[model samples]
Target: MRLSRRLEKLPPYLFVEISRKIAEKRAQGIRVVSFAIGDPDLPTPPHILDALVEASRDPANHRYPETEGLPELRQAIARWYRRRFGVELDPDTEVLPLIGSKEGIGHVAFCLIDPGDIALVPDPGYPVYPMGTVLAGGEPYYLPLREENGFLPDLDEVPAEVARRAKVLWLNYPNNPTGAVADLDFFRRAVEFARRYDLAICHDGPYTEVAFDGYRPPSFLQAEGAKEVGIEFHSLSKSYNMTGWRIGMAVGNAELIRALRDVKSNLDSGIPQAIQLMAIAALDGPQDCIDEHNRVYQRRRDRLVEALRSLGLRVNPSPASLYLWARVPEGETSVSYTTKLLEEAAVVVTPGVGYGPSGEGYIRLSLTLPDDDLEEGLRRLEAIAHGRPVRL
Candidate 1:
C-alpha cells in the first residue's frame, strides 16, 4: 500500500512493537513477565472513579464539551499548579485539557513547526516528541542526553544554525524510558535557551507527581522567565492511576496554550465531560494517592535495581518515574540483550535503541508491575544471567 511521505518518515511507535512481541510470546503460551510499558497496574482511586460515574449519569454532561475544556476542571488544574509549583495560572487562557499529555505534545509541535523547520528533541526521550516533528514536516535535531550532562540536554552544544532554525524544543523530566529528573536550574537554562532561540519550549511532565525520596518534580513555569517561553504538559495518568481516563493539562505560556488549543480544536473534540469532572476530583481532591503511588514505585524500583545489580547489570534507580535505565551487558547491543531476555527468559523489557541512536547499548525496565510479577521477572532475568537453560 502506498503511504504519504510524512507517514513513511515515521518509525513504528515504540510501545506498539513491544506490545506485539509480548502478544507473540503469549500466543506461544509463555507467561511473559512484562516490564516494558509504563502503564500503571494500580487501579484508579475510588474517589476519582466515583466522580466519573456521577458525572456520566448526568444528562447535562451528555452534550459536546467545550473545546477549551470545562472551566471548573481547568481551574482545578490551575489550583494544582499553584499549590505544587507556586506558579499561578490564568486557567481560562493559560490552561487547556488534553486527552493525555501525548496528544497535547503532538498538537504543540504542529502549532509551532512549519514544514522543513527544525525541532530540538532529546535522544532517548519519548517517541512522540520526534514523531510530532516528523508529522509536521519538521526536521528533528537530537540532543544527546548523556550521563555526563546528568541526562539534561546541553543547549550550548546545539549547533548555532540548527538552534536558529528550530521552531520547537521538546523536553521532559522524570523522563520516560530514562527516568531522569530535571531540576529548576535545568528548566531555567532551557527557558533561557528557548528565549534566545525564539522557539517554543514544550515540556512533558506526566511523571511529576510520581516522584520519590520526598522529591516533588517542579513545573517548567516555576522557573524564572519560563512562562515567557515555554508550556508544560501534565497528565493525570501516572498521578491518579487514570491512564484510561484520558485527562491532562497544558499550562505555561498563555500564547502557547492557545496555539495548541487552536490546533486541537480543528483536529479533535475536547475531553469528555465525565472524564473532565473526574480529572477535577483527581486534582483538587486529596493528593495522598500520589504519595502512596510513589511509595509503591519506589519499593519496586529498589527491588528491581538490586535484582539487576545482583546479576552484574549496571542500573541506577531513578528518584522519579517508574523506570530503571540500565546498561546492556558488555558484548551485546540493546536489541541483542533485549531479544535474549524475551526469548530465553520470557522477560519483556524495552530496548534503549528504540528510543534513539544514543541508546544503543542500554535497556529500560519499567517498575509498573505488581510485587509478585516484578519478582518473577527478576528471577527470570537472574536465571538468564546465570547462563542456565530455561525451564519455568
Candidate 2:
C-alpha cells in the first residue's frame, strides 16, 4: 500500500537521527557523553511518586479517563497557574491535559489549520511546530529569530500577507535550542498581532518554570488579552522532572482548548488517571524541589558557558532552560563542528542545523548530564581547543 502523501512529504524525524547516531557510538563500547536531547536526567520527586503509588492502588483509576482531563488535575493546574503566573484559568473550559506537551504542540495545528492555510513558526525553534503544520496540510511560514533580535522573532519582519493567511502562530520560550526567554512586552505585541491577523496563538511553554538567576519567564496568558486569542502548553516534563509521566496542560482561550480537545478526543483516551493524580501532587506540592533542581542546572550552565567562552567561541549565556546555544567558528557548519566534537571528543551535542536553516552556524548543548560527566566533556572540549587546529 502507498503511504499517505502527507506522510511522504515528511523527512526523517531529527531527534530520531540523533538518537540513532548515539546508539551506534554506544554499540562500539564508547561511553558517549550525550548533550543531545532536552530530557532531564533527574528522577521524579518522591512526593509525586508516592502519590501515584497510592492513587494507582484504587481500581477507579485503572479505568478509562475523561478525554478532557481529571477534574482535580485541571483544578490543580488552575491553582498552580494563579500562584505561579498570576494567570487565572477556568478548569472546566480553559484547561485540557495532554499526554505530553509535545503531543499538544503537534496536535494543535489540526485543530485550527485548514489545508493550504499558513502557520507562522520560529526558525531555530522546536521542530514539532512546522512538522505538525505540514502534517495538517498547512504551509509553515518561518519567522527568523536572529541573535541581534535577542533570538526573538520580529513581528514587523513577517510579510503582512503571510500573517493574514496564518491560522496558527507558534511561540516557545525559554525557547528550545536557543534557551532564550520572552518578556511580557513581546507577548503583548504577539497577542495583538495574532488577534489582528485572526490567528490562533499557540505558545509551547514547557520551560515556563525552568529559569535561573532570579529570572522568571512570563506566561503567554499573562499578557493583556492573550487569553482571548492564545493557548499555552505546559509540561511537568521539564519543571518537575516528570518526563515519563506523559502529562501536561494547555490553558487559555476556551474555544481553542475545546478545539484541541475535539481533535484529541478521537485519537487519545486522555492521560492515565494515576498520572493525573501524580500531576496534582506535582502542581500543588512544594515547589522548592524545582528551585533545588534549577540550582543544579544553574551551576551546570555556568561551567558550560565558561568552558565555551574560554575556547573563544561566541555564546550568549542562557538565563533560562536547560540548554546553551553557542556559535561555531567563522565559516564552519553546525553539522561539521558537532560531528568533530562527537568523533574527536566522544562528546555528543545537537547540531543547530537540526533545528532550522537560520541555525546553520550554531550548536546546542544540553545541561542535563551529571556534573562529573559535564566536567569531563568540558575537559575534552578544552583539549580539542588546545591540540587541534579548530577555529576556536
Candidate 3:
C-alpha cells in the first residue's frame, strides 16, 4: 500500500508511542504512575457543568451552532481580556472561538503557509508548532531556546535569508515543556522582530493563569504594536479545568481571524451549542475557583520540588503550567533516564527530547495527579535514588 509522501515524512508522535509502550508494560502486571501527559486532572466546576446540563435540555440547542461561537461567549471572552490584561478587543471580529487552542494553532499554519514558505519556530518548544508547519508544506527554521538564554529564543540570531522567506513565527509564553515565562521587554522585542520581518506571530498563552509567586503572565497583545503582527490563543483547559470541553479562542487581527475561520468552516461545524453556553458561564462566572485550584497545585509543586532535590536531581520549580522541567543527572540520555524511572519507579515522565532537539538533557513531570498519588510517586522516586528497588 502506498501513502502520501507528506504523511510518510511525518514522524510518529512520541507521547502516543511512549504511552502505548507504558500501557503494554502495565498490561503485563507492571504498575505504572503516569506523569507524561500534561492533562489537567481537576473536575469541571459544578456551575459550568450545571450550565451545560441546562443548555443541553433546551430544544433550541439541537441544531448546528455558530462557527464563530455565540455572541455571549465572544463578549465574555472580550470582557475577560479587557478586565484581566487591560487589552480590549472587538468580540465580533477579533475573537474566533476554537475547538481548542491546539486546533486553532494547527489550522492557522494550514491557512497561512504554503509550499516553500518558511516558518520560524522555537527549539525545545511545543511539538505541534513544527509539525503543523510541515503538515502545511512549509519549511521550519528552528530558533533554539536554550537554558543559556533563559529558554527564550533570540530573534536577532535568525539569518536574513530565512527571515526574508519566513511567513509565520510561533511564540508561547509561560511556555509548555519549559515553563519559562516571557517578560514585557521580551514581548516588545518579539513584536519588533515580527514587524521587521513582516511575519505573523501566533502566540500560544494556555498557561498564563497557572503562574506562581506574584508573577502575572502578560498577553502578547499587551505589548506595543502586537495587534498589528500577532494573534493570541487562549485556552479554558488549564485556567478553568475545562480541558475535556475542548473550548478555546483566538483573538487578534481581523484578517487572520477570518482566514482561520474560513479554514475551520470547511473542516468543522464548531463545538456543540451546549459546550459554548457552558463556556460562556466559565468566562463570566466567578474565577475564585482558579485561585483555589492554583493553591493546591502550588502545594504539590513545593512537595515534588523538595523530594526531587533531596534525591539529587536538580528540579526547577515551574512558575506556570502543570509541569516540572528537571535536568537529568550526568551520563544519562533523556529517553534512557525517563524509561528507567518509569520501569523501576513506576513513575512515568515526559522525555524532554519529545518537545524538541534542545530538550535532550531534561524531562517534564506533570503535576496533574492527586496529592496522594504525587506523594507516592515521589516516595518511589526517592527509593530508586537510594539504590533500593521499588516493589510494586
Candidate 4:
C-alpha cells in the first residue's frame, strides 16, 4: 500500500517502537518494568472527576461544543495565568481550547506556516514540534541543544539567513525528556529575538506546575513585548494527572488565537463539554493537588537519580518534569544500550537518539512508576550494570 508522500516523509516515533518491544515482552509473559513513556501513574483527583460526572449528567453537555471553547473554561484558564504569572489575558480573544497541547502544537504549524517556509526547532526536543512543521509542508531547521547552553537553544547563534526565512519557533520549558527549566530572562531574550526576526514563538508549557525546589517557571508573556509575538500552550495532563481528559489551552497574541481557532474549526469538533467542565474545576480548585503531585514526582526523581548513579551512570537531578536524562556509559550507542537493557535487564527506557541526532549516547527514564516498581526497575538496572543477566 502506498501512503501519501507527506506521511512517507515523517520519521517513525522511537517511543512507539519501544512500546512495540514492550508489547512483545509482555506477550512472552515478562514483567518488564517500563520507564520509557512520560505518562503520570497517579489517578485524576477525585474532585475533578466528580465535576466531570456532574457535567456528564447535564443535558447540555451531550451536544457539540463551541470550537473556540466554553466561556467558563476560557475564563478559568485566563484567571490561572493572571494569578500564577501576573500576565493578564482577555479570555474572549486570547484563549482557545485544545484537544490537548499536542493537537494545538500540530495544527498551529499548519495554520501559521506556508510551504517551503522554515521553522526553528530545538534538537532533542519533543518530536511533535518538528514533526508538525514537516507535516505542514514547512522545512525544519534544528538548533542543537547542548549541555554547554544549558539545553536551551541560543537564538543569537542562528544565522541571519535562517532567521529571516523562519515563520515559527517551538520552545518548551521544564522540557520534555530533559526536564530543563527556562528562566524569565531567557524568555525575554526569546521574545526579543522573535520580534526582531518577525517570527511567532510557540511556548509549550505543560510542566510549569510540576516544578520542585522553589522553582517557578514563568509564562512567556511575563517577558516584555512577548504578547506581540508569542503563543503559549498549557495542559492539565502533567500537573493534574489528567492526560486522558484531552483539554488544554493556547493563550497569548489575539491574532494567533484567532488563526488557531479558524484552523481548529475546520479540522474537528470541540472537546467534550464534560471534559471542559472538569478542566475548569482543575484550574479554579485549590492547588494543593499540584503540590502533592509535585511531591510524589520529586521523590521519584531523587530515587531514580540515586539509583542510576549507583549503576555508574551520571544523571543530573531534574528540577521539574517527569524525566531523568542520563548519558549511556562510554562506548555504547543509545540504541544499543537501551536494547541491551530491555533484553537483559527487562527494563525499558527511551533512547536519546529517538529525539534527534544530538541526543546520541543518552537515554531518558520516566519517573512515572509506583515506588515499588521504581525500586525494582533500579534493581534490574544495577544487576545489568554488574554484568549479570536476567531472564525476561
User: Which pairs clash inside model 2?
Assistant: none
Question: Which digits, one per residue and each the tens of the lDDT, describe model 4 over residues 208-239?
Answer: 88887878888888999888998999999998
Query: Taking the candidates one at a time, how many backbone clashes does each contain?
Result: 0, 0, 0, 0
- lDDT scores of the candidates, listed in order: 0.88, 0.90, 0.88, 0.90
CA lDDT, candidate 1, residue 18: 87
Model 1 C-alpha lDDT per residue in residues 171-225, reported as the tens digit of each score: 9898877889988988888888888988888888888888888887888888999
lDDT of 1: 0.88
lDDT of 2 by residue, 1-392 (tens): 98788987787898898889889878988778888888898889999999999999999999999999988899999999999888899999999999998999888888988899999999998899999999999998888889989999999888988888889888999899899989999999998898888888999888878889999988999999999999999999999899888889899999989989999999988899999999999999988999999998998888888888999889877999989999987777999989888888888888898888999899999989988888788778888778863221
Off by over 4 Å in 1: none
Total clashes for model 2: 0
Better of 3 and 4 by lDDT: 4
Q: For residues 181-259, write the lDDT of model 3, one tens digit per residue.
A: 8988999998888888899999999999998876788999999898888799999999989888999999988889989
Q: Write down the TM-score of every candidate.
A: 0.98, 0.97, 0.98, 0.98
lDDT for model 3 comes to 0.88
Stretches of candidate 3 above 4 Å error?
Answer: none
Clashes of 1: 0
Cα RMSDs, all models: 1.0, 2.0, 1.1, 1.0
